[model samples]
Target: MDADVWTERVARDYDTSSTHMYAPEVLGPAVDFLERRAGQGPALEFAVGTGRVALPLSERGIRVAGIEKSEPMARELCGKPGGEDVPVTVGDMTTARVTGAFSLVYLVYNAITCLLTQDEQVACFGNAAQHLAPGGRFVIEVFVPDLQRLPPGETARPFHIGEQHVGFDTYDLVNQHLVSHHYTVEAGRGTTFLSPHRYVWPSELDLMAKLAGLDLIERWADWNEAPFTSASRSHISVWRKPPSRTGTL
Candidate 1:
């Protein structure tokens, strides 16, 4: 599904359903990583759902803006304190444009996979470059595709199993596609939601960045800057645009 469809459906319950992501242990390091990179400059987020990272980062004294496809999600963010001050452009992150340049352009929590096509993902990199000042950084947090969890001939792998929620990812190896299936139970009622995404490798992302005139600067296992190794489940990657140089016209 596209961002508009899936994100709108998930908006109402996103904060509650994704509570684990907002926990201090998980969120603190992420905010710190971005805060250090952003310094005193402005930062822009792509697919900034419900202001999960932006709000707190703003409270740290950095200017924050966002590009979100779902109006419902943006509305939810606007309802929060200080959310009214955030300038959000309602459009596809791949093509959305906001005024001025940003020192950091970030997409966290596997949001890049939501684009579903390689071309769209590359376009997203280009869009991020367009919004960034020279020498600015683009950061992404995403899970590494874990095909090892899939047994021989198995197409689906369960990633989460809990009393209230069960989640699995069904892979299409040929197309590099995956659909996350989530079943949530509450009050003895079950609801299922399927979100389509295209899994991308770190090398492929580096190429995308290079195509947009950026260079890979860092790759960590997590927001805490752990060394990225083969056993790591996810990564926080950063790329930077080259600083401008003065030249005689």
Candidate 2:
């Protein structure tokens, strides 16, 4: 996470600018999916911006903590209605140590892409695994890279072209690097937000989990449990630590 990029200005406007994601229709399903796997969590959210998902889980009586690198974003989250109850540590998700063995640890909304390197992402998986007890699960929600959709000579794809926001992604296929350009117009003033990410294939993520001693348990196209297919745009993946036993294998 880049604190320099996520300035106070960005954090201040985050909730208002992305109000659509706060809608019950959008957050309800995500919360439900996580709550089910929480199984008496103590869930930990990586990059828990503005407590978008954490507070809701807390509302449902699930203990939720968070690791956020951007202090402004974490401050914005901590000030929410029930935010104070959800303890947040302002630190890197890849290595931030928070107490408690979580039943579920999750990174949502492609936040893993922010790591911008294979090693950081792999370390993030390790950290999540470190925080989990035996039989615990880790979840990640991320988009499938749109390389297939790009025209032969094109390096960018426009995903949103609405009045409030115009957004697109530019790809560096050789390195699997991606930069999302978000142009927003509000009150006659326009602002541009450029977020860089390293896109990883689903298979790569599964291998990362395996390297961390986790097993792939389930995968879906969405929080609704839609089947993940070649045509899917995004995916929700689940991996579980092996059940505890008295003796080692």
Candidate 3:
């Protein structure tokens, strides 16, 4: 991901634009799932953003740390209440290393797609594994590629249409590339932001986990533990690092 993309303006306005995601119905279940799997203490979040999940999770008494590529975003997170308690490393999630290990390492809200390439995505999994203790779990929540929903020869689709904001995604099917275009009207002014992503299949992610020496343990349609099916538009997946047999990682 380009750190430049998340400027101070973007960081400042992020929470407001994504207010719906912070709703109790959406955030509560996600935090509950992570807290349950977060074993004794610490958890690491990738692309922690404006401390959305990390803050609440920490409030729940879990020790939360984060790796964020954007200084502006990290600044926004650090400025929040109780945000100071959670340490954040400013660097690439695919290569940055935080001190010590964690019982859980997670990348939520489709952050993995930000890597843009299969190799980078796989490396991100490896980095998560690097931060995990033996027997620890690595989790991710991401949208499933909806190519099936795309009309033949159609390159773009609208994902959100609202009075305050509108969003659409354009696809480059051959390269597995997608760019989400968002336009929002605020205070009688209009602004736009475009975010690029690399869409990956569920099976492809499983293979990435295997390459990272992690084992898939569970897959759910949502944080509510609903069964994931072919019709599911998104998924939450958990992969476990093998327990050390020789007292070595």
TM-score of each: 0.94, 0.96, 0.96
lDDT of 3 by residue, 1-249 (tens): 888878888898888777668989999999999999996758999999999999999999999999999999999999999999999999999999999999999999899999888889999999999999998999999999889999998999888788878888999999999998888888988778888999999999999999999999999999999999999999999999998996533
TM-score ranking from best candidate downward:
3, 2, 1
Error of 1 at 34 (Å): 0.7
Model 2 C-alpha RMSD to native: 2.1
- Pairs of colliding residues, candidate 1: none
Stretches of candidate 2 exceeding 4 Å from the true structure:
246-249
At residue 85, what lDDT does model 1 achieve? 72
lDDT of 1 at 12: 80
The superposed Cα distance between candidate 1 and the true structure at residue 245, in angstroms, equals 2.2
- Candidate 1 residue lDDT tens string, 103-174: 999999999999989999999999999999988999999999989778999999887787777889999999
Maximum-TM-score candidate: 3
What global local distance difference test value does model 1 have? 0.90
Q: For all the candidates, what are their Cα RMSDs to the real structure?
A: 2.5, 2.1, 1.6
